[model samples]
Target: MAFSADELRVLRRALAVALHPAPLHDEDVQDALLLAASVDEAVREAGRLRAFLLADLARYREALPGSLSGYLELLRDALAAGYDPQADDLAALRALRRNPAASELLARCRILAERSVRARLARVSQATATSAPTGPRARLFALPGGRAADDEPKPNPPAPAERPVPKPSEVFPPRRRPVPPPPPEERAAG
Candidate 1:
């Protein structure tokens, strides 16, 4: 899975072709397909490696409140493999806070955890903000006359007086139909 620089270059080129479709020569197409297969294999290998690292991390974690050095090393390896540190990791680090060997690593882990949290929050907030309604709008499909994209003429919302409130019964009427009994012969068979 570990590609040499030459392989990396080839992989990148193949990826470029895949991402940006253009008429490729037969040889180029074949090369890209081969590279794609290699990439898939590499991905599988990375996943296996990650799983092994996570297992190692768990072993170290369970041996914790001791073996700070090994735990920290495994923790770093897990992090490198895209493992998110959990509450248990934080708790363990906190317990090891007094260990001089653990102080720097503890601080580093705390920072990494915080940074990850902030990043996740920011991503969520960005998504929410983007999706949230920004006032009533019948956004123009085609450009409006003499209006820039920013000056989009939005449709006005219905006034409170204009908005009709439905009665509960009207909104959700009770079901009228009852379940019919099974045929006599069918019921007898059952």
Candidate 2:
């Protein structure tokens, strides 16, 4: 959101007062409160506008071929306004792919959808990385007779004795002896 020069001045003064903890003039306090309220109102208005656009887009999509042009136009506007394409939008565009405009929009929407998915994955991975436990975890189950599994130091298993590995010929012998070829086809005769 672009802040007007007057709003910027008010915001600067408010930040300075906040950081410095100085007594502010009544006028400055009122200006800061008004600016904050305006910002909140602007946010609410944008949300309402986005909701209306989505509802209109849905209506246009439902009207199908008859509203193809309007739907495409609204969809383009929605995309430009940072709306992520929904499954319904993708499906509708796929069904109307015969139209060049719909085809182009479909490609654009697919790219946007992929980007949205990647961004969500990145966010999820970031959250998981940040929130995952870094220390040793407690055991879920205990041994019988009130003994915890990790209470005692267990002895390591004994290693097997070293042995020679058998060659393939020793493991899998030939099933039968090789038969000699006929002596030169019986000197080229049957």
Candidate 3:
């Protein structure tokens, strides 16, 4: 219904060729076809762009809510474009309740969000219960500098079997300090 000036001109020329019995320039026909192809390409690109925008908006909405992001605007666009809300989308809409239409969406998403949570909890419990011992389960000592000690490869256990195990006395000899006797309680310095 909405034709650009160039499109209208092309259409007029075509109509002229159709109505008036004359050989219109072959280049003009090709030009009109090319313009139509370009228009179709533009439309396809716009659709792809919209899809990308919608996907990004959903991702951002699902992420932890932070400072004023363009979530609401994206949501508005998505809703106008008839995007189905996911659990995260519902949660986001719930948080951003200024829009009246959000109430309906929130209600619809409540069950979805609950199911999502239950599924997550179920997965966590399953993992905890069924996880096989991954390389000796023990209370591992953490390393200095906040790194996990176990994560680092252990210094290749002294390759030779004759790794001289140092005796306790040799490794950590006792320290004998002379303890000075305390002065007689302030020597009755009444």
TM, every model: 0.61, 0.71, 0.40
C-alpha RMSD (angstroms) for model 1: 14.2
lDDT tens readout by residue for model 3, 118-142: 8889999999988867686788775
lDDT to native, each model: 0.81, 0.94, 0.71
Candidate 2: Cα lDDT at 183: 98
Per-residue CA lDDT of model 2 for 1-190, tens digit only, reads 8999999999999989888998889999899999999999999999999999999999999999899999999999999999999999999999999999999999999999999999999999999999999999978974564666457677676668656799999999869988888898796996
Worst 10 residues of 1 by lDDT: 141-150
Q: For model 3, what is the alpha-carbon lDDT of residue 35?
A: 77
Instruction: Compare the candidates by lDDT and give the number of the best one.
Output: 2
List per-candidate RMSD values in Å.
14.2, 21.8, 17.7
Q: Which candidate is the best by TM-score?
A: 2
Lowest lDDT 10-residue stretch of candidate 2: 141-150
Can you tell me which runs of candidate 1 are displaced by over 4 Å? 1-22, 137-190
Full ranking by lDDT: 2, 1, 3
Which tens-of-lDDT digit does each residue in 24-75 have in candidate 1?
A: 7887767667777888998898888888888888888898866678998888
Error of 2 at 90 (Å): 0.7
